[model samples]
Target: MNSHEGRPAGLRERTRRAVQAEIVATAMRLFLEHGFEATTMEQIANDVGISRRSLFRYFGTKEDIVLGDHAEHGLALRAALEARPADESPWEALRAALKSLFESLPYAPEEFIKITTMLHASPSLRARQLEKRQQWAELLMPDIAARLGEATDPMTRLRAHALVACALACSEAATDAWVHSNGTIDMERAYDEAVAAVRG
Candidate 1:
């Protein structure tokens, strides 16, 4: 075996990740507390006790800090879709995957509501969010095409696009309903109703 193969666990990697997470968390809190445009990189760096240069090393731009690392999520979602039983229809697979996704939403509903509310009010962040979702749709389309067995066809691509769009629309509507209700109702129920509206 190569000498590097049996090396001790990488302490640097863990430390770097800890620092990065702290920076991102601080940025998010700042962004929520103050408007996105008002929260400067210097403020984030200061809050995290790091140099601005060090902060840039971890995230090139402020937007990257708030978005939290979605590149890995697409790969994981595709893998989940691929592992789904072959007999299931594309819609079925997508619905099941989405249910899992909704149930496992990373942040608390309150946090998501705050972040999304901020995003919705800000033009630059709104554009970035759209771009990120577009990238995710592009990443997912091919796998979906293969599963639906129309890899070479435009119609399949359209369907996949529509499906992702529909899902996002439903989730966003439900999120709005949840937020406007101010924690008085179960957000999961709102999400389910949104999905049902799409299904019907």
Candidate 2:
């Protein structure tokens, strides 16, 4: 038998995921209490009862800790877009994919608002947020190019980038409206209206 035969597959992945979640949770709490600039990796590691080196193994920087969940969201958004029915128009598929991705958020709307507020208040975080959106656009490009039946054309690539940019803009606008309303506005409705406006 092999040296490691019969072990459960993905056990290492599961453990890594668990540790990452713990680090994120701890870092978020510290950031909320002390502000992002004031928080340190050492403090986060100490709070989570791990060494700074161990923390670095999971995240490369403080910004990564703050925006870690966003990376997952980008991946999920790409998957949602890719899984959309081929018969659906690009605009419709984009709208449905955004809605589905938003609905799958593990946190409540209030928590999202808090995170948004934090991001807006921090220049570094806002930069990271834009970077994440750009990454999403990159992720969506190939799928969009295929969906539009112009997989190898330069115009198709530009169009795909424009569509993803528009979607990201709509999402930002909806988030701004929600924040301005103090969470009284329904996020789903706001996002839907924003997307529809873009489609028109």
Candidate 3:
């Protein structure tokens, strides 16, 4: 039974999500094991027990397997930021909004290192990651501006943009620290430390 709707998810939707999650998990393992560039869609499709044609139905390309969730995450962050109390500091609200990101992490800390390490090492993936960050910042900027009580001043918009950019940078730094330390570091604490230094 699904607590949100008080009923189970439809069989097809549940099955689809399960299959996609399996594909993502398996593909990450493969990408880490064999370099991402070296890994092929056919290989992922084979490993996931689906035909290559069917894999395309779930994810358009190899990169999508890695990044398909970013769009949902951007929307989630925007919604979370909008839900924060009006009096909350933008930084605090952003930090809280990021809880959705952390909560949606699909792998264990150790397994996450594989994904992050691969992304850190790949230029193509890094470029796509930056694009996704820019998209997220754009999505959250309006909510941030609202929280700042800034309506139309250009400077207000710029400040909101800066805050969103800085928050993302802080997140990246913390994730990098955690990955470099082989996940021994607490990511949220690392993020807090980065923010403290940035704010100081």
Top model by TM-score, which number? 2
Count of clashing residue pairs in every prediction? 0, 0, 0
User: Residue by residue across 9-54, what tens digits does model 2's lDDT show?
Assistant: 5688788999999999888888877888899999999999999999
Better of 1 and 3 by TM-score: 3
When summed lDDT is taken over every stretch of 10 residues in candidate 1, the lowest stretch is 3-12
Point out the worst 10-residue segment of candidate 2 by lDDT: 1-10
Question: What C-alpha lDDT does candidate 1 achieve relative to the native structure?
Answer: 0.76
Candidate 3 displacement at residue 97 in angstroms: 1.6
TM-score of 1: 0.82
Tens digits of per-residue lDDT for model 1, 1-200: 67775454576778888998888888988998888999999999999998999888999888888775765665666667677887777666766665666566678878877877888888888888778777767766776677767778889888878876776666668777877786677766776788787889
Candidate 3 Cα outliers beyond 4 Å, as residue runs: 1-15
Preferred candidate (lDDT higher): 1 or 3 = 3
Clashing pairs in 1: none
Off by over 4 Å in 2: 3-10, 196-200
Q: What are the runs in model 1 whose C-alpha is more than 4 Å off?
A: 1-9, 183-200
What TM-score fits each model? 0.82, 0.89, 0.86
Candidate 3 residue 46 C-alpha distance from true site, Å: 1.8
lDDT of candidate 3 over 112-197, digit per residue (tens): 78888888888888999899989999999988888777647788899999989999999999999999999888989999999999
What residue pairs clash in candidate 3, if any at all? none
